[model samples]
Target chain A: MFQNDAFRALDRQESLRLLAKVPVGRVVYTRQALPAVLPINFSLDTDASVLLRTSPDSDLVRAIDGVVVAFEADEFDAATRSGWSVVVTGRATVVTDPDEHERLSQADPTSWMPLRDPVFVRIESEMVTGRGLRGTRGTQ
Target chain B: MFQNDAFRALDRQESLRLLAKVPVGRVVYTRQALPAVLPINFSLDTDASVLLRTSPDSDLVRAIDGVVVAFEADEFDAATRSGWSVVVTGRATVVTDPDEHERLSQADPTSWMPLRDPVFVRIESEMVTGRGLRGTRGTQ
Candidate 1:
């Protein structure tokens, strides 16, 4: 997995592993035909789908449903100049199945805020890519 | 400004101020008619333009030049459950003028890795928006 001396390319499994490590990521979607990004806490489903729980009336729910969006999560340490980022690009769809919703509710995905009527938006991990950067001292 | 009990909306000035506090952000652009996001180190120019220095032949330069892109930066504390995020939407342009490039070169924007021949991409702050999340205990 070669990229450069400083950055190492990560494969699909490694990318999904890192994606599940972070509890939050920024969701990129089209707003008014232009791109907009919002940081949201998400849970990685067993199948690698990025699941977002938010209020039913939230703007994010309206904008991202059935849309091809990108979800990115990373952890970077400026002091060490080391970090890894994973981006998942896929079509986001609202989870409307009763059984699946009940199963997810039992899993207890992390949420930043409690919503009275929470809706789940699941982003299929159709394309996953990631990279890790080595520190200046050649350590990650 | 008002958003909800958990999130507070920020004005343009405050948004830019918070945007300057972080060293890295995700750049969102369109790839093959689908949204793609890549984490990149950036510097907020004095005028609020997001400046990125990378190799001349980097894929980002080729993909984002003259295209509208979204840049997002945030600082989140999971334990505290508080953070601020700022998003800047604008068109990215490559710095081609000699005098302007000379001035920017002297400014020394932060770069994750040293590049032999660096090119500058400037994203104008055409639209800026931000939000702050209050901790569960009500402290930010």
Candidate 2:
């Protein structure tokens, strides 16, 4: 086999589910010649897409057109000794349709990030992956 | 002030320091209508700058041309009951000069990620921010 199980991963729905439960995640993309990572609040849509807002003349907008990118959302509670992370890899496109635009416009950013720009972009999942770790307390 | 103190918080150096420790982080930039996030493996330069590798044709190279962006890295240890996060916001430009490029080219990505590409981008922190949380051991 030409694949190592370490690199081989999961599908969209499973990754999306893990994403939905978490309130935060980092959006990864390339900036300049190096990889850039930024923290953001995101939402999981019915179509298995992740939505977030940005500015019109922003660098993020400049680099991310017609590209297969990765998106992730996750959460952890150290007290309970449990946590889960979900990553979504897909093609990101800036949505233009009005009804779709209105839907994002009407959504809340406070649930995600305090500072949200005027424009919104949605990433439709081509593939999604996730992993979870849970600890159980038991009597020895 | 009208702000959620919990979300609007950081320590400055922590974001930069955390980036050095955690190889994986999210990159945020604009992609048309929405803010995009992708996962990346990065290292912190001795001066506290963040660095990563990429291809010349990569989306990052195109988007981060002297633009303001954020490079964030973080970590959470449930077993240790502690966590911290770091972020850098600044302009990203390509390493057009040769000498600077060679220094970054030698960074070890194996412990980080399998990054292929010669181009390097530095998200110099115009403003560095950070935050941390630690769980307490109590009667559970």
lDDT of candidate 1 at residue B96, scale 0 to 100: 97
Per-residue lDDT for A77-134 in model 2, tens only?
Answer: 4344345566677777787788888887776344322333445667777666665544
Off by over 4 Å in 2: A1-11, A17-71, A74-140, B1-10, B77-82, B107-117, B134-140
Give lDDT tens digits, candidate 1, residues A28-115.
Answer: 9998889888898889888989998877788888999998899999999999889999888999999999999888887856577756
TM-score of every candidate relative to the true structure: 0.93, 0.54
The model with the greatest DockQ is 1
Predicted complex 1: CAPRI docking category: acceptable
True contacts kept of each: 0.37, 0.11
TM-score of 2: 0.54
Model 1, residue B9: distance off in Å is: 0.8
